[model samples]
Target: MKTVLFPVLISSALVLTACGGDDSPSKAPAPEVISQPTVAVKVAAAEPVSALERGEQIYKRCKACHTVNEGGRNRVGPNLWDIVGRDAAAVEDFAYSQAMEESGVVWTEENLSTYLLKPSAFVPGGRMAFAGLRDEYDRDAVIAYLKAQSPAAQ
Candidate 1:
């Protein structure tokens, strides 16, 4: 019996030794992560609006008081037909301020630019209640619009 038990115990010990190491399951290695290169991006600039188109939009302010068409009736202000080259206060039957009537000036583009910048400063005691345009682009746009609307331009 002692001889048989000793052989059985030796065989069990050998079997346990063969199954050694950690009890947890074996795991595969994780995949390596690759980084991408950075890139530079450029944005395109927007197209600029034409002066005539911009002026037409700005002139909506004037539409309340004046008309730029031929034979268009005057409103709070006089009709502006041929206004770019016409004399100051030249609209017939439309009453003008004493300062404007006596200004004795032609409606040159430069003169118009100055006047539209500050109506009161251009002609003290004038009756135009419009606050002048501060932006040079706005003044230029409206001038282009008025010039384009003229019969002479056609």
Candidate 2:
């Protein structure tokens, strides 16, 4: 019994010696980082459309219903001579749908592109009887052509 007690005490002592103390130093509190408020930025306006080199090709579809030459008579729809920047449904000597007249929208590049893509969607109940141009590039080209024909743009 004495021999067994001696060995148990030695083992316990060896285990206590093997257990290490904490060696790391105390750390300072970290500073808090405050985030700044986000601001909305304004971008510069887009550049104006240049000459209609590709527009002639795109205008093939539009030519069925619109004429670009000044003094050209209205076809199924009003003549689109100098259409850009013109008041909506303001073609003289031609009857216009109430939907188009009431839209009160001016024909800008953005507006014209949207209108050309889906005329019925742009001006609900308007009477531009043809299906819309689906391609964005083609719409851009058509807008360029209309801009070229505008009196102010000239």
How high is each candidate's TM-score?
A: 0.71, 0.63
Worst 10 residues of 1 by lDDT: 21-30
**What are the lDDT scores of the predictions, listed in order?**
0.91, 0.82
Instruction: Encode model 1's per-residue lDDT on 53-74: one tens digit a residue.
Output: 9998899989999998989999
* Highest-scoring model, TM-score: 1
Best by lDDT: 1
Model 2 lDDT tens row, 73-146? 89888888888888988887889998988899999889998998888999999887768889888788778877
Pairs that collide in candidate 2 are: none
